[model samples]
Target: MTIIDGKLTKHYARVWDYCHELLRSNPGSTVQVGVTVNPDQTTYFHKMYLCFKAIKEAIGRDASNQVYPIAWAVVDIENKANGKWFLELLTEDLNLLDGGGFTGLLEATKEVLPNVERRQCARHICANFRKTYTGMEFNNMFWAASFSTVESEFLRKMDDIKEVDPNAYENLLARHPHTWYRAFFRTDVACEAVENGIAECFNAIILDARKKPLLAMFEKLGCT
Candidate 1:
């Protein structure tokens, strides 16, 4: 899981390092990481870990002009807690000893953009939920809970989750409903979006382009 962002083709670790450095060097810059994961593995590899060490060794001998720092991990599960563990390792590697510098997006957003209303993407929630719970029942119930525009309706949907599985109910309960569900969003925004579908769609459009060489990827994106 590598992602290319604008001029930087960085692995997740490199991105974390870059953000950490930028913030430390220049206090004016704002940096935040929205933690998420692909619930399923790729077709070729069923395992959840990347071979970063092997890739790093290969890169060491290569004479390429480009610099690609790799950071990989083997996680028992793909969840927010495990994601934080991966970040902790990266922080240690980057020598960000002050510890308190890194903060979750929710806290940062409140401090930096207090007036702004934040909405969690429903599709992302579904992806994370699918990690622990599956099938159409859970999916439908989850969406129902998310889409509910009334507090009573939302509670009803949650009750549905509790009926299906008390553990699943607890899981969903832990996921901060006020940010994702329709009932809790500010009415002033006049936006009813439950998911970040536009960004997802754009990523899908550039899926193949992202796997190509730098120049080739740019060319493909230009054409797209």
Candidate 2:
């Protein structure tokens, strides 16, 4: 345990010191600290991302051989600033070229990765659709629209949705066809990935860790 000024470690030790300790212990690790500026020139705690060497190596050098465990962060809040900071650090650490054959999906990723082709997670898209529309038919229609690899096939499924419920079809349409529908997706990267299930899996695995203090959370996430 690290000692503080005349006391043992508190519920939460200083993040600044801990980040340094992490870097010292793990060589070739990337740690980024972000802060929010107040009107009075004061700064507030934001979030941070730690991309250890192990995580980077696990992702490999190319999509063909790469695993998708890119990086993980402990975000205090999922706001615009924090989102931008996390991706910016990731981009810098990964050294991904501007037009690198890569893509990111969802809100936080969208905010920073402006050039990379963005798509929607299939499960998330379906879950959001279910909030307003129900029934096995709608689920099938949604998947039909998403998994359709040909333009004509995609249109046919979309039309099926329109026939079932014009309002639901309109709602889905409002969410931009290119963002989720596979037919509209570009294969330049040859990623061939349509779902963000791996990222979601981390969410489940870290659900308990998220409730821990920042330092403990970082330690827990670093473990196998």
Candidate 3:
């Protein structure tokens, strides 16, 4: 599977070219492409539309054996209203993919490829936990268990929390199953491949870059 930012058309094109090259070089081998987008980026919706368009164009009239192109976007659901809007937009996009008159991209792709699967980010799940249950001792234990790979150990910790705070335990477990429970248990290779450390590294780079003003850095680098 190939993962890329949906916004980068050049990068997407290069990845598509590489996939075609690999297929031509080694016949009878299967390849799949996955594009990841952040919902916060306003342009991502348009980018996703274009991606489907490209896939349809590439596959041509007879898409009997065309490869599958899966598109995914992650949304932060801290604010209820904004979250609702994001979900609505996602539904609209899927509707378009399903057959909303703009193009028969989904129909062409579905002729050969399977349906697209939507997935939520585990990081957003953690953030939702932080938002809903703030400043509680159980929050630490819950987060620790959610982030840890040792299932037995995590369950043991959760059991201890339930013993002390049964109400909170039950409420959180029922309310946020996808976030707290499924996130820890779901076995998706692509999602599991993501690590908090990588996000932290990107954050650190952004912080370091922000230490100097944009113009100052450009001037220092002799670009101006």
Candidate 4:
């Protein structure tokens, strides 16, 4: 916000200090500032990532039951470096030596979530299937492939897909059955969920905040 005629606080002006103050006030806060060296040799602001106390704790508190940010970043550029830096900081702050897990950007997850598994969103898959294939049998077979608690059941349904619609079956094969199917997910985490809607919910909660100034938005993550 511009102070057209009022007193100016360091909160909006001195970004570095503001970040430090946030860290001081909130013990578990995590903040990363990305900077780029200009041609003139001076460093300029690039982007930032902030994970407040609540999220920090959520990542570190428990193994089986934990809250994980499902693919998010604060960088202007959505490239590998930015993602790697964000996750590297997150991993350091939370001591997440292994994959803590998240949904949303599978590529971002791939950069950080090792040992942790990926689950494909069944609803999204169904939506896509509806676009390419006809008949309820395809949906039923997809569901069967996803819902199967055992390997045999999943394979049987997959075979069903191959038989019914060879083209759709080929598409399904491309998506990799292990991602959505329960028969293939790791039993370590409590999440048997095949939907990535957590990202949706998280985004909705922070959507307004995301448009706010850095400090203001960063503070919102800590409150919850």
- Best candidate (score: TM-score): 2
Clashes of 4: 0
Per-residue accuracy of model 4 over 24-115 as CA lDDT, tens digit each: 87686676566755578764544666675465443222376544662244665667877788777776766677675533235666767675
Q: Number of clashes in every candidate structure?
A: 0, 0, 0, 0
Q: What does candidate 3's lDDT look like per residue over 1-224, in tens digits?
A: 12322233554446556556645764643343444346666543111111222233321223363223322222222344443343334344344444222221222233222333232344555566567556667567766656556667767767877886776567556644443333444453223321234334434544543344322322222221
**Candidate 1 local lDDT, 1-224, one digit each (tens):** 23443432333335455446645864543334444445664322111212223232211213553323334343435556655555554444444344333222353234333344666788888999998898989999999999999999999999989998999999988889888899987676555667866445556777888676433454465466
Model 2 residue 167 distance off true place after TM-score fit, in angstroms:
2.6
Error of 4 at 187 (Å): 1.5
Residue pair clashes in candidate 4: none
51-88, model 2: which lDDT tens digit per residue? 86555432333546433565777665667776677677
Top candidate (lDDT): 2
Q: Which ten residues in a row have the lowest lDDT in candidate 4?
A: 3-12
Error of 1 at 37 (Å): 26
Which residue segments of model 2 deviate by more than 4 Å? Answer: 1-11, 37-43, 54-68, 106-111
- The per-residue C-alpha lDDT of model 4 at residue 88 equals 79
Candidate 1 Cα lDDT to native: 0.59
User: How large is the C-alpha RMSD of every model relative to the true structure?
Assistant: 14.8, 4.2, 14.5, 4.8
